[model samples]
Target: MRAYTALINPISGGGRAAERWEPIARLLREAGAAVTVCPTRSREHAVALASSAARRGEIVVAVGGDGLVRDAACGVVAGNGTLGIVPAGRGNDLARTLGLPDGDRELARLLLDATARAIDVLEVGGVVVPGNVYAGIDSMATAVINRNRWLPGALLYRLAPIRAVLTWRPATYTITADGRTRELRGQTVVVANSGSYGHGLRIVPTARLDDGMLDVLVVREGRLHRIASFLRAAKTGAHLDLPEVEVSTAREVALAADRPIPLCADGDEIGTLPATIRVLPASLRVLAPTAPRQSR
Candidate 1:
């Protein structure tokens, strides 16, 4: 029997993680796996718990959203353990990227098999981000989502951008990718490892977790009236066709702005501008399907 430790964020998905994990835990136990449940009090606590369990040669399962998954990955990397994920958060972006199953029975079966796949991760200012790191208006929208936790997940993610755009100001952004620099006046810049975020938006359609490169997207400053259309286009990755959008791939990226602009990764605010992000190739071993479903 495999030893597994589940680090669950009690309040994730509007306090639905624990409720969602119950059936999965029961299934694992029925499969004869030794499953240990740990309810995380905070992000720091989740990391610590994951590290300790991983050091014991146990599979560390993150049972929450992308934020919790990032924390668990940090600890698992430190302890050199394999990772498992259960999608019980508002934005299961990483789970979506890995093509993890939504149903409890399917997820439990996948967990029991313990199939591991190596994937790339983003290292930004000493933090591990499994999805994408973004700045400008998207970061502001993340701030708005964080403040209004009472709203439903999809509703909050959809409305936050509109709320953020009301006060957003364009910034002169300097982006250096693999030492090649470019300057642009933009409202959003995204360095993506996973193609999808904001519940299911295909922010960068060409990004892949094992690609060993970062997909850098710059949304050039445009008329405020175009924001809604751009967002709608982003859902199907059609925004890349817009003249204001630019996409490229690089191994490392440095971002700086004329003024302070907040940066957000894996659904949490990391820091401000002048940040350096690099891809750690094949750094994470995750229990995922043999073939990951790509975002359109």
Candidate 2:
């Protein structure tokens, strides 16, 4: 029987992560797996717990959202252990990218029987991000979401963007990708390892987890109406067609702004630019379906 260590965030998804993890844990135990549950006190605690468990050759499962998954992944990478997910948090973008099942039984089955696949992750200042790293308006929205955690996920995510857009102004950015540099005034810059974020929005539709490359997207400054249209189009990945939108692929990306601009990974703000982000090719081993589900 395999040994598993689950690090669960007590307050993720408005206090739902713990509630969701119960059934999953029961199922894993019933299947003869040795299950250990650790309720994480904070992000740093989660990383520490996962790292210690991983060093013992136990599969470290993050039973929360992308933020928790990212934290656990950092520990797994540090200890060189496999990572698993239960997707019990708001904005479970990484789980969506890997096509992890939603139901408790299916999720437990996946943890027990799925094949581990190697995927790329973004590294910024020693932090491993399993989803996209972004700046500008989207980062602002992330701040809003963080502050208003009491609101429902769908409603909060939708409203935060509108709040951010209202006060957002275009910033001059100097972006370097694989040594190629460009200076532009833009609303946002996203470097993606996973295509979806903001509750399934296809921000970088062409991005792939195993590609060993980062998909860089820049939304050039536009009028309010045009920006709104771009956001709507982004829902289906049609924003790539907009003239103001530019897309490229690179192994390393550097971002700097004329003024201080916050950068976010997964769903939490990391720090202000200038920041250097690199793709750690095939650095994370995750328990996912053999043939992964494609993001729409």
Candidate 3:
């Protein structure tokens, strides 16, 4: 992968990734690798750049947060090139979950020399949201997106799972899995494909990226204030042990609603939705090890 092309979002997270641009370029030149870096003008441009590189069989790197990575992943997954990350976005959730290094140089080495493996991602109508779990249901689903305003990192997240719990409650929604369909009221309906969502919060700790199945996390219905009460319960992942919380798995998921629900993919809130998501197992090639513990 000496001939490499990177699609970097300079404006992402206010140019955090761009901060390392020049030095990284210098190092790559010193390493005798041919490198080309391009800044994305918008969200859609990320995929356009990635798609162009994929068709050319070039090593494509995404230098932003999970949203940019997910966009690039969609572009390169069907092609023959490896999809890489630079990790400069706010959440960096996908990078943390994948056990990738901090920034440019480390990422360059990984792109140039590391072994690659195909990993699974949840594609909800062409948008790829990162993480292993899709928690909450219908109106409760909007609660997860609203929770993003909580502090921002790990310590804050220790308190986030419980945020707005009292103000929010489960809603009635139809769910289908393994050919079984039922109507249930729940606060969140999570689909887990990986363990944690950056900042070290594990919604589903045992998830695997290549398993070809999505782990489902369901929390039972509750009053608006009761949902807020779970703030403390979420700290230890005890929310899963609740009578309302149910775990299941499936190859595909479809969510339809009479009202708009906040939907986020890889940390970038796409829109409110009635949508479908499916597991594309071992779809995109990864440069790092198979699991978090196995990564060097």
Candidate 4:
């Protein structure tokens, strides 16, 4: 049957996503979708599969976590297809943003049933690089983060303070946004496309996908415990309310680093700095969740 299919990441969400294939397929079939299933074997494979699926004008639902969704996003954003999600991952960041249910089969039905909305995308560029992915942080941070990367999803936030303390102090960097420029010495600076990082952390909680603006947050020098305290406040939308956290809005932000810093995107590591970011408004069509999404 020629119908919309799901691209599943076998390693996502502890491989529980693969376990859900049968039920999700049945649900999609019941919803009048043909339900062709595609499994991603690697990063390049995901890109190839997603691009191929989008080329044929097929709606590809992400059946795994954010990494898989990001991979699928690379494909759909360039083509006529709209992307949907089933939140089965260590961090279902995008899924929560879309207000989809936790169950794979249920989310499939919900996405198939809802109205599609066009959302923005951030294309990050560095030196000769130009691509569609939000470089969340510098690459130096990615190295330090990867050294202790074996920790589970939620604990990574806890490790941030430790990384801040041990991985050397924050470097002074200059950032220019929309003809205005400033400098900051911080441990973490995030360029957010959509709100929510994962595991209930609101790095840029007030962000909106349709607003045509990118939100930037910088966590400046602070005690490790204080940094943890700040993350807690972010959970309830209070982190940016504090003096330690600085919030700014701009169409583009350029960062200058003495050395390449660590970087991350969607939920995985991309190459390091320097990074140039610009928001493309309403760049993608998405299946909005039926119910109201909880405030991110």
Candidate 5:
């Protein structure tokens, strides 16, 4: 039997993950498996636990949301071990990309069989991201949303961008993608592997995880009414048709601005620009369903 480490973030999903870990662990053990449930004391702790277990060639399963997934993925990728996800996080955006099943029965089946698929990763200034890397107003919005965790997750996520655009000033952004350089004043810039972020927003609707390239998107600064319309269209992915929106594909992207701007990957703030983001193609082995499902 393959040994497994379930890295549980107790505080994720409003503490629901911690409360639910016992049964999940029991289920794995009952199936004739070696299951070790590791409750993460902190993000750094989760990294250490996962890294140590993965280095020993154990399957490291992330049992929380995107943040925990990112940490566990870092460890698994470093050790070249397999990664599994439980889809218990708030966004579960990475799970959405992987077409991961939400039910416990399906999850157990997946962990046992351990179907492996190579997926692309993003390296933003040194932080490893399994999903998307973004910056500018949206990143600022993420930072703001983190501070107001008392509100419901969905409401806070949707409102943060609107609040941010109202007060956030547009900056002149210089972006070089695959050696082609361009400068524009935009509200946000995104390079995606799975293309989804900000609580189900299809920020890059056409991005593919194994494409060996990143989908680069830039939402240009515009009048308030125009920006509002752009956002509305973005909700349904219709914003791609707007003239102010530019989409392209690249293997690497470097972003810089006149002022220091924060950057985020999979919703966690990594650092500020000027920074280079590159695609590490087919780098991490992810345990996904045997049969493919529609990308959400």
Candidate 6:
């Protein structure tokens, strides 16, 4: 029988993955799974390990945050294997979208017993993003969040974007979505697969994982206070109703800007933009909850 391989990031969850591994392993084994725990040395290493394990017909479980999950997804996509998640990472936003249980024991049980469902992922500039693709001020906030993994919980989530807003500036962004091209001076252009990011902020409130289409959000440049107000509105997904924000849906989106703008995928900086993102419908097979919590 093909065993389950757990690809764990040691630094994930502020280094909590190492502390949580033993019990997670024990639980899986007790549940009659042939578990092979793989501690990843680096992001690239995790992808390599997951890809290898999946090639052997084993289910690959990502035991960390969105970054590790993104890496594991790449491996699973490449090898055509099923993916599972044990949300030990800080944000666990994707886990939240999947309606994953808060408790680790329940999470482990779900991983071991759950059946696979196909989900859509974004193909952004050669990267496989299982969640959302964002740029501008939002990406800046994500950069801050990525740098301060030690902050933990509320402080990290609340403060990072606050800091990002202080240094925010708009750029001339040219965007083409579903063949509709437009240009604007904006703060962000987001293509969401799962919607929420930066610790549950609904950047694109209506985005769904299985929608077979991507939700694109645009926030044009505004006064500092207005921008701050927009950020606050985003928490309750009220930003979508703001006049400064525009929302659209498409199967593909291409973005470019006059200056080099930072880009992020699944809450980690992938690279700067001038890229095309397309939806791959029902391409990823993973263990997902039947009912996902709606972010609004």
Clashes of 6: 0
**Model 2 scores what on Cα lDDT?**
0.90
lDDT values for all models:
0.90, 0.90, 0.66, 0.67, 0.84, 0.84
Q: What's the lDDT for residue 188 in model 6? A: 85
lDDT per residue as tens, model 3, 154-211: 4444444445454554566667765677777766666777755635556665567777
Candidate 1 global CA lDDT score: 0.90
Candidate 2 off by > 4 Å: 292-296
When 4 and 5 are scored with lDDT, the better candidate is 5
Q: Encode model 2's per-residue lDDT on 1-296: one tens digit a residue.
A: 77999998988888888889899899999999999999999878988998999899999999888899999999999999999999988889889878888899999998999889999999998899989999999999999999999988888888888889989999999999999998999999999999689988889999999978999998899865555566689888888988888889999999999999999999999999999999999999999987555542
Across residues 53-153, which tens digit of lDDT does each residue of candidate 5 receive?
98998999998889899989888888888898887777788898687877777788788886699988988755678999888888998888878867888
For candidate 2, the per-residue lDDT at 249 reads 93
For residues 1-296, could you state the per-residue lDDT of candidate 1 as single tens digits?
Answer: 78899999988988989899999999999989999999998878988998899899999999999999999998998788899999899989889878788899999999888579999999998888888999999999999999999999989888999999999999999999999998989989999999688989999989999878899998898865677777798898899988888889999999999999999998999899899999999898999997645543
lDDT, candidate 5, residue 4? 92
Candidate 3 local lDDT, residue 228: 44
The residue pairs in collision within model 1 are: none
Instruction: Look at candidate 6 and give me any clashing residue pairs.
Output: none
- The runs of at least 3 residues in candidate 3 whose Cα sits more than 4 Å from the true structure, single-residue gaps closed, are 103-105, 129-169, 223-236, 290-296
The alpha-carbon root-mean-square deviation between model 5 and the true structure, to one decimal in Å, is 2.1
Over 4 Å off in model 1, which ranges? Answer: 292-296
Which 10 successive residues of model 6 have the least lDDT summed?
Answer: 287-296
Pairs of colliding residues, candidate 5? 65-89
lDDT of 6 by residue, 179-211 (tens): 899899988889999988877777788888987
After superposing candidate 4, which stretches have Cα over 4 Å from the reference?
Answer: 126-152, 160-164, 290-296
Model 3 TM-score, all chains together: 0.83
In TM-score terms, candidate 6 sits at 0.94
